[model samples]
Target: MPSAYVARVVLREPVVGARTWAGFATMCTGMFIAILDIQIVATSLPTIQSALGIPPDQMSWVQTAYLTPEVLLIPLTGLLTRLITMRWLFVASVSVFTVASCGCAASGSFATLIAWRVLQGASGGTLIPAVFSAVFLLFPDERQGIATTIAGVLAVLAPTTGPVVGGWITETLSWHWLFLINVVPGTLSALGGVWLLTRDQPSGLLRELDLAALSLLAVSLACLEVGLKEAPELGWVTPITLSCLGTSMLTAVLFVRRTLAARHPVVQLTMLADRRFAVGSALSFACGVGLFGSVYLIPVFLGFVRGHSPLEIGKIMLVTGLTQLATAPLAVALERRLDATVLALLGFGLFATGSALSATQSVATDYDGMFWPQIVRGLSIMLCLLAPTRLALGHLPPEQIPDASGLFNLMRNLGGAIGLALVDTVIYGRVSGHATDLAARLASGDGEAARAVGIPQALFAAHAGEPADPATRAFVAPLIERAALAAAIDEAWILIATLTLVVILALPLVRRRAEPTLEKTP
Candidate 1:
């Protein structure tokens, strides 16, 4: 393991008399709140759409609204640390997030809800980097592993359990409860943060904000996320889609160039020069893409395609969440014995395998088909994430931990955007082709058995509130049902293929390093 020289310096200064346990608790609490808010809203989208009367096409914007600001603001974390005292920045962000949660709960219109969600994302984006900085500052080298274990467990659990929490609220209460639940926790965290967190005065040089870099980063990231999100609906070749993609790419290039040239760049590109950090960051990006993409795909498969209720879908995810929770501690223990890179690669492989299994699912598949795959995925995530985070930040100077964390997280977000775009595009194309073929066959009056498996003529006549002519109903309804089933199956296959590719990519990247071990730490 690395020496505690960096850790000692940070603790002796910013943390003052704070104990390790107290610091850990505070950071964990803060991170839990931030992550919880993001996940809670995800499962409640169905209820939110019904309650708000939002159009089907516009519903995704609720998620995009939050994601846009969150990712866009992530790269600025390093700059924020220099400008404001950590304590004040954390408290202010919690306040913003808390207030926004309340606003979401009280919102009567979709527009108002989206605006509050954007504010919430912007504020919540600062929490993770700040917490990582605080944790690194409080723990010594030997205990850093334990600190990370605690934090990482929570990070994994927040998203895993989100569906369960959201489902319970939406089924028993209302969608508004999703946002309302956040207010209490956020408020409590804000109060706790102010009282417990030690204040660090800002460095005079960094206190002056760089408005130019900030604006450029915000616009560039927003454009990139927006373009990716819109590509599926608008078709990538369409003029409007091409314009958004082109503009996003241009702005991103300018942002990178400006950062490299500026006297005080918002993000330090020099960090990427470190081979370990570079590899670790790449892994993080792939993990993010696979993780978020599956999160989106799984719920859609279970609920919309399979006709499972929100509560039922949530119940299924509970098994996966519990499995991950069980595996996290084991991962921390194994990291002590194994090479971090090997462990991460193994984890990624398991995750990819799980995703492949999930992709093979069909309308007839049951919980048995999903259970083991989810457990494997949970285990893989634990192994993959715990070691890579340590590997990524372990070698950095204590003062630079915040910057490294922020940059790592930013890449993960970007990876998620790219993954979502890629998966959706593939699924869309595959579904369209399958739907067209199925329609054509049904129209040709071929394969009576296949046509009967799709839509029954009597059911279609009942839905129409009149006895449909049997031939007409058979022709139209089977085509519609077959199209829907084909689309769902196509999505599953795409998710499987994407995850398999991720595993293949990760295998070559997992290289062993002859680093010192934890017991040898000074």
Candidate 2:
């Protein structure tokens, strides 16, 4: 068995005499609120777009607005930890997010809402990793396994519950309710953060902030995130796209150089050299891709292709979320007896398998077919997330825990951005390719025509929603049928390829160490 080691050292000094569940609960509540806000806006997007008259092309920015600040701020977390007391930061972040939520609700234009979301994300970005560090530091070494388990469960659950909450608010009330709903939790968390969290000021020259690096870091990440988000809509080779990309790359290079030269760097570049940390961050990146890609894809499939309501998607996701919650303890328990590396590998395998299975979905597939994949995927994530985290920080000195956690979380967030972009690009390309190919076949005077392929002319006729004489119907019917089938196949193949890549990248990171049995704590 690996020796029990202090995973975190509280530099600020612990105010509470001993760790209690209440303390953990309070810490997690802050994290829960932060993550909940991240996802709650997702299901409400269509409603927001319609009510605000947002262009379809600009609709994605609502999400990007939040994600951009969040990703950009993640690396800065370690620096923030040194610069400010955790208690003050937590309270400030919660307050910012709450106010931003209100701003989002009250916004009259797309630009205003996007601005609020950026503020919300920037504040939220600091809160999450800080909370994780707090939890690790609050608990003793012996209880870390349990603490990690609890933390993992909350992380998974917040996002899982988001769709359901967002859907309910969007369907039953105005989309504004999605933002307004956060007010209560946000207020409570802010108050709780101030009351429950102890404060201590860090000493020495490290307390001084690096203004140059901070500015460069923010500009670099903002440009990069905006570039990635806009690249799909703006032609990649366009002057604007090239400008954004160039600016992002240049700023990023400067940020890195500035950090290395700074007396107290905003982000510690040295900690990344730790093999466990490096490997874990890489795995987290891949996991982020699979996680966020599915989060985006599943609802799109259900609502657009299957014609399900937001409420129905929420209901299905609720089931999947609950299953993940239920499996958290089991996964944690299993981790004790297994090497974290091995567990992560197994988890990723299950996730890839689940994605592969989901790729086989069709218009005729029902809830039953969908439920199993979600269940497997949920269990897989529980195993995958915690193990990589454990493996990454396991060998690090306690003082470095916060730095490692921040970087690990940052990579995952960046991975989500990259994954979503990649998947969307692939699906769009494939769909267009398939559509063009299928259109050609339909136009060809071949024996295996649309009629020969067993597609009903009426189905395509209904899709056009136009009354057609037999001549018009015959000409248009085959094209519509071919297009639908091609789109479906294109989507499936893209997901298949995505999952395959995830498995391929993840395989090497699995640990070759012998499994150790976890002992129960009293």
Candidate 3:
């Protein structure tokens, strides 16, 4: 082929070559922060809540505000790409994200904090799907194996390192540093993208903005997310909760009808018709539940149940991050030669095994008890990110890849949201029941129960104004609460384990992704 013709082809699509590494890094920086921001704040929630004087009931909105907008924007990324060149969209988003981080750090009130979080999430959500789209567009098959591995590392590494870094920042310094921390890295990613990459991202022909669909999507997802977050504390029967649910459902129905009927739909829902795409999406959702669910569980169990400090919790969870990097090279190696089905099954098996080991934990479980399970999860998580990506995307026509990637990533986020809700329900529901059962036995002067809680049966005064105040039935209440929480945490672990293993049933629906053309254009 003539050199000029080759140049044109390269211009049309991102050609895999030397500069690909630099561009990938720039994009990864944006992706890492977007994803990492979720967990970094996890360890510092209490500090943030108290610092801003947030009421206990409203504290959850700090996380929910960010996550809700993030999830809402994910499915719309492909549509955005169609409107603007991807490079410009990404750069603009990183800039918006950077500005929002600063606003969050400067916030002095609960409402102010939530306003910034919504902006931050809106931009951060687009980066993940953009990176996934870049993987196929920028590289060929052999290189894609290596590129995907790198992406997997960033994806898994973000949340894994978040707790550790966030813990250190909170314990050693102040909670405000959590948001201030993003400034340097975020700026560089946005600027670096402008400098290193050739700006050739293309857009679709139709340019009309679908305001109705956009409004419906935002209202539906945001209302639903807020409702879910508040339900645990507010009680599902509360009028506020019910209203949020009702409004969300009405908006969601409108959004769906608008999407299917529109000439240029904001979302291309037709992709779900592909069997491979559908099955792959389910795998993505399940992995999201496992990945996000487990991440949520370990920290809460260690912090609330065991009463560990943020730094100590970080140290315990750091094992998962360290082990994820350790296994990346090997996972990439296996990904190269093995079928997606085989790799997915293996990853799912390891993750399930790890979750099961964790389910056996009692109130006494600690760093040592959790070490093996963390290791297994870290090793398996990379394969979870890699194989499903290929299964969902490797065979799609390149033009359709962007839209498909958006939908694929959206499922994972949805899974995380739903998984957390279900796990919360299970824990809250079980705690009261477990406490009741244990209290009944204690009330009867069960010697075993007395010994288990370190309270002497004789310490009870039997009447008000007890003599052994410190050792009275009041002391026993703490034990029952801890015991009940431990039991709830254990049950949550079992739920996640079962969810992870159930992926095996969907294995038959998948076919190994076809290797794409790796050769430079003729």
Q: What are the RMSD figures for all models against the true structure?
A: 4.7, 5.1, 4.1
lDDT of 2 by residue, 160-197 (tens): 77778887888788888888877887898888777766
| Candidate 3 global CA lDDT score | 0.83
Segments of candidate 1 deviating more than 4 angstroms: 1-19, 204-208, 439-522
Residue 223 local lDDT, model 3: 92
lDDT of 1 by residue, 112-149 (tens): 99999999899988887677666566666555666777
Q: Estimate each model's TM-score.
A: 0.87, 0.85, 0.91
lDDT of each: 0.73, 0.72, 0.83
Model 1 TM-score, 2 decimals: 0.87
Relative to the unseen true structure, what is the C-alpha lDDT of residue 273 in candidate 2, on a scale of 0 to 100? 68
Q: Clash pairs of candidate 1?
A: 1-516, 1-517
Model 3: per-residue Cα lDDT over 1-522, one tens digit each: 466545545534555666777987898889999888988886788899889898987787788889998989999888888777678878988999999999999999989999999999999999999888888877776777788888878887788778889988987898888998899999999998887655765666655668889899889988988888777667778999899989999999999989889988888888888878887788899999998899889888898778898778878888998898888899989998788888889998899999999988777788999999999988899888887888888767666777898999999988888888878988888999888877776776566655554455565324323333455557678888887887888898899889988987898987554534445664
Model 2: residues >4 Å from true position, as ranges?
1-19, 203-207, 440-522
Ten residues in a row with the worst lDDT in model 2?
5-14
Which ranking of candidates, highest lDDT first? 3, 1, 2
